[model samples]
Target: MVHDILITKENPFENDVLNFRDHIHQFCSQFIFRKIPLSAVVGITGEWGTGKSTYLKMLQMHAEGKNKDVIYFNAWKYEFYEDPLIAIYFEMESKFKEVLTLKKYKKVLNDFKLYGTQFIKSVLINSISYVSEGIINLQDTKDNVKKIKEKQATLLEKRIEDLKGAKELVDRFSDSIATLAKIINENTDSPLIIIIDELDRCLPPHALKLLERIKHILSVPGVVFIIAYDKNQLSHSLKTLYGNDFNIEGYLIRIIDHEVAIPSLFSAEYFNKCADKVVLSNNIYIDKFDESYKGLNPFAVTNILMKLSLRDQQYIMHNIYSLNNKNKNITKISYLLVYFYFLGGLKLKNPSVFKLFESGTITKAEFYRKVLPALNPLERDEVIIGGAEILMAIVLTIISLIEGEQNPNNLTSLNLNGVNLEFNVHLVADVKTRMTTQRITNLKNIPKLYSEYPTFSLD
Candidate 1:
């Protein structure tokens, strides 16, 4: 009855699983497609794997459906290119070619291509020269001094000329974009909308260069930019460029006219659906631990899942699925499902503490202290009221089961805050026997045991 955990790749507009249609409609109608006097850069910011890419896709489809010209550019896909401007220019050129013939817009495109290349090259050469001047030895001599002075004078003159040319080229480039935007707006009655996605995934220099290009050259009338990125990750990239002490918020404010946060996908209903697809689909018994132990609180579990990114949520679920699949008999003991869920949360929320606990380097009491503060008030209350003790008892019971005991005599009499919680020793034993066969002797081996499952990194 187990089902594989497949990452959903269907179009968000088609499926609308995350219920983003309303948000997409509102943003497009209210801000994006609405007529404004000046061009604007709007940022759609969210944490990594919070569905920024999918959201952008939805926005693009909506814009296109409204008869607005939309350009979807993924910066990371072109990170290998030295200059992001080149990639952006090509993307614009390609998209525009569909509406206007290449010959008609060829001159503007060529001018942009030629000047942008020259400007970038000039900057690189000047930077190299400036650096070289600092390291080069310049010894004074009657003949060499005159020569050096002459060379400096010539270089300074050329540098001024280059600067002027670069300025002229930049101005021309801006004018070309303005003209193009005007033409497109006149033809379609809507400003050209460009959706720049995955900018946070690019190298620091590439990402910063693209941002600079947008601010200085591409921010023209009749054009609007919707940039999707992880704000924190992009901030880190900015810090990598400007220094750790740089005012990231101040700088971003100057670049982005407005920012919209992606709506969170966490809710009790969402978690229940994920659970159905991941855990319950396997026919696992998750209703009650025993006559004394009730099922996991849906709200409490939602709170924990909310603490993790979408990628982490899937990761935890998939690992749990792998564990249950490997030891099918463990599914019969409904209470163990609670422990598994807790373990997954522990591993994700505080990996350092989880590692210590897994290696047996920390006791149950120590683990409890470290993880308690991370939980919400409700979860904290649950932990204090028999949750912690019951978890420890279950671990001991599982260990005893692994040791081939008919009954864990020590755990049989275990009491949790004056309440006795019974254990299904046979089911617990089955889990251990499978683990033993897999060479997993202790908690530390669990990660290795489930290492075959895919893992994702937060941006």
Candidate 2:
């Protein structure tokens, strides 16, 4: 499993949705992160499965590590209301009320009686969230299975009954939830770090409204709304919503003009670090990831690979020819070359795609063709130069999964048949709903093939 970070042969670091912090390290280190009282909104751009959420988390942790006040929220989730700005108002109200002492905390609560219903809700729901999400591995037990099952059955029945009453109580009190979040932030040592992911996944019209709302309101002090986005797709979504004339990047520029693009949150260097941490140093080699290929970006590499295997991607042109000589209006293969590097030794295990959840509006295929394209534009001209190179790096990252290179950072696995990670192929939408998807590119391969995508181990 790609879950463990230490004492595992397969790297867990790459899987750290929060590992992409290099982009903000400088700004954070120099200007606000360690030095000043700065309230800045750092945004990220990536398609749905490109792992923006994980990387944003890494950045937040990195900031918090440096002792900065960080607050984060996903606008797509927070801006579910009609005003959307209420999401903003809720944020402000929560922070202010939290500064009060126990006495103040109570007085603040009394003054916030209107939100009593919400406070109960926030606490009740979060009390459940207070549990660690790490899956517990049970040791083998040969005891009485039937009796254990009966006991668990009784416990669940009692718990469900208790929960039912609590939920009803909370449903009537939503405002207090906001107040609770504020109090929670106040007691924490670091800044309030709120990560709002899947911005580009919402309805086009609704998403645009939320974006505008964030621009106007989410900039409150002590809260650094770490927004995760895929700019290439987001702009397109905006076009669909506002108009063909709407310029999404331009609109984003007017407000969130500065964005921290994590070029290689999944870079070879980072993954290499992960491998060393998890596995015995003797089992891995230093030069396995081909250090010189650093300049190539990750996305560009994956893009070219996807295109090449697409039916061998032949090109044909028809033309009127001269006497007897066949005339083909074939232009130069420059565009193809422009897009590809030598298709070197490489193999990938696209993670098995599965329907995690579904709402009536969002389907599995629709998630990719519609949602994914915007969140992670697999094929597109990028604003940042060297996109092709960036993709080359990505190709190697794929190979890392296949051959188990740098398995320390983020362990990727594959069965003999391969894997395909997808989300909501079945669309069951739940509130606080996350896009149900898979990490699809987990891979595995032998040494000879491993040498193709990533460098071979020295050992």
Best by TM-score: 1
lDDT of 2 by residue, 326-378 (tens): 21111121111211222221122121111111111223233234323322323
RMSD in Å for model 2: 22.2
lDDT score, candidate 2:
0.40
Cα lDDT tens digits for candidate 1, 174-282: 7777777777777777788999998998899889888998999889998899999888898888898789998888989989999999887654444566677777887
lDDT of 2 at 192: 50
Candidate 1: residue pairs that collide = none
TM-score attained by model 2: 0.40
- Candidate achieving the largest lDDT: 1
Error of 2 at 174 (Å): 19
